[model samples]
Target: MGAGHAHKLYRPAHSPVHALPPHCKIAAVLCFVLAVVATPRTALWAFALYALLLAAVAAAARVPAGFLLKRLLIEVPFVAFAVLMPFVATGPRVHILGLSLSESGLWGAWNILAKGTLGVAASVLLAATTELRGLLLGLQRLRMPPLLVQIASFMIRYGDVIADELRRMRIARLSRGFEARGVRHWGVLAKSAGALFIRSYERGERVHLAMVSRGYTGTLPVPDAAPATGGQWSRAAALPAAALAVCLLGWTL
Candidate 1:
């Protein structure tokens, strides 16, 4: 994992949440989300409790409410899809405010909104507290496939480079008074995209060759570190344990 690959989502902090091993946090978030998804949507109160649990994690992590809420905007497309379910889905209808909505669709929409939002919130909190490099390292520690880790590492490392290239291309276009106002400009935009892809592919090839020349192998070297302590594991398990309790209640009650 490269130190140059810090993402905007990570907020630098000295809190205990930030101090915990990256792998522990990753596992905790994963389990927490699983528990959330397994929860019964009919248990509305359980969803509220789940939100509170995440809120507690955010407070421990020193992540602001605004930060979490803003990143949640990424799920707008999912929300839109969920919203349409009630209108388009066929099932028993319930009238609310002069419109007939499927009862099953309402439940489906609620399920998606609740589970999806909680999952996204959990992920946002993880990303907020963990750097991209740390996340790749954590995945490696968790025994994720080396090839997948390498792909993610390279993507994180070069995503900015690709974006910068696109920016420069846009600047060149703007300098030449190329404005994308209508379908006529789509050709130029498509051509620009194609050129960018070729440049990126060529760059990847050069990077690969350079690595091979320098004793590159299928696996990247991992820095040795002590495994998470029992105490740390217990602490990290707290979130998921609480969520599991709630999920059980959701199913039973």
Candidate 2:
């Protein structure tokens, strides 16, 4: 990925969290999330502990609470789905304020809400500290399929170009007094989308050809770098270690 394609989620900083290797951070986040997922949903204290752990990490990373909260809104759709569970789910109904709700559904909703929120928060924190290219590199280092990593890399690199193309097309439409005010304009919108797809495809072909001409191989070249030191691994492992402790407590308690 091009260095110019820095994702909006990354915040440039000199903190220790930011200094850690990308693969280590990726592994840490994955382990942390797995621990959270393994925890029993009914363990309310466990969830609170998880939140506090994340909060500590956020503070250590110097990520703003407002920034985290704003990005956390990405989970709103899942929250909406979970909200309906209590009302729509059947079996073992409980009366609450003259309305009956399924107890199982209530538990299901809590599960979704608690687990989903924690997962998203962890992801947001990861993104906030790591750049898009770093994430792709991390995946590549972690033995992820090269094809998938390349696809993600290209998507991140060219996503802005595609968005800019869309913006220009919209402007051209507006210039021609083509307002998409109703279903009548659907045909125009569909045609525009089709054209965009064709253009993107053609661009991809050209890029591929250029790479082939430049002696491109099936896999990207890995940079020669020092392996992670024992200290670095321990530091990176700390977050997941704490999370695992919480998971064990949740299970045993």
C-alpha-based local distance difference test score of model 2: 0.92
lDDT of 2 at 242: 98
What local distance difference test score does each model get?
Answer: 0.93, 0.92
**Separate clash counts for every candidate:** 0, 0
Best by lDDT: 1
With a 3 Å backbone cut-off (N, CA, C), the pairs that clash in candidate 2 are none
Model 2 over residues 1-253: C-alpha lDDT tens digits? Answer: 3566778899988888998888999999999999999999888999999999999999989999999999999999999999899999989999999989999999999999999999999999999999787888888889999899999988988899999999999999999988999998899999999999999999999999999999998777877567778888899999999999999999999
- Tens-digit lDDT track of model 1 for 8-82: 899999998898899999999999999998887889999999999999999998999999999999999999999
Clashing pairs in 1: none
What does the lDDT come to for candidate 1?
Answer: 0.93
Query: Ten residues in a row with the worst lDDT in model 1?
Result: 1-10
